[model samples]
Target: MRKIDLLFAEYGESHQNPTNKFIHWICVPLIFWFILGFISLIPSAHVAVLYYGLISVVSIAAIAVVSLYYLKLS
Candidate 1:
């Protein structure tokens, strides 16, 4: 099996129970959003020359790191 398929199959194994599936379906996205919002509470810094570079925004950094992790997994 491909890496993505294997990853998804492993994920499926964990969610086999109905109650576990229900809770994960409801809570997982909420938890992800909550973490993003929590990190966004921190202030961002301006990069004078770039005009659009709001650097040091913790939420964006967190998302970037998460994306990298997903990439590695895939």
Candidate 2:
């Protein structure tokens, strides 16, 4: 009944298939890795960063963006 619940229910509707779920399990990580790889290529991405692989400032920025989207949805 709530807007966030409705959003989740709509999203869940398409994921009822087991094959789709399995494909997502594989593709999600691959896509995530691809995104991290892209972000890592940013100029000066390595200098003065107190972090490890896949945990750079750009990745944190991406997380913030996603969190903001969810916050708006909720």
Candidate 3:
């Protein structure tokens, strides 16, 4: 199996119980959306200028770093 699929299969083993699985399905996305919305409310401060040259601010930079980390893991 592919690496991502194998990883998911192993992770899925823990949530095999129906109640726990149901809780995760319901809560996880809600929690993610809430957190994203909370972060969006933060007032951004100027952080840096890109080499090619767009101005970067704190909130956008934070999201970019997180996105890059996930990309690296994948």
lDDT of 1: 0.80
C-alpha lDDT of residue 30 in model 3:
96
Alpha-carbon runs more than 4 Å astray in model 3: 1-11, 45-63
Expressed as tens digits, the lDDT of each residue in 1-74 for candidate 1 is 89788889999888899999899989999999988877767877523437654544566679899999989986
Best model number under TM-score:
1
Residue-wise C-alpha lDDT for candidate 3, range 29-73, written one tens digit per residue: 898667766775677654455664433364576678879978987
| Local accuracy of candidate 2 as per-residue lDDT tens digits, 1-74 | 99778888997998999999999999998998788779766653433545543445676677688789878876
Error of 1 at 36 (Å): 0.6
Better of 1 and 2 by lDDT: 1
List where candidate 2 sits over 4 angstroms from the true fold.
47-57, 60-74
How accurate locally is residue 32 in candidate 3, as Cα lDDT from 0 to 100? Answer: 68
**Candidate 3: global Cα-lDDT?**
0.73
**What are the root-mean-square deviations of the candidates from the true structure over C-alphas?**
5.1, 3.5, 7.2
Q: Which is the winner by lDDT between candidate 2 and candidate 3?
A: 2
Error of 1 at 52 (Å): 14
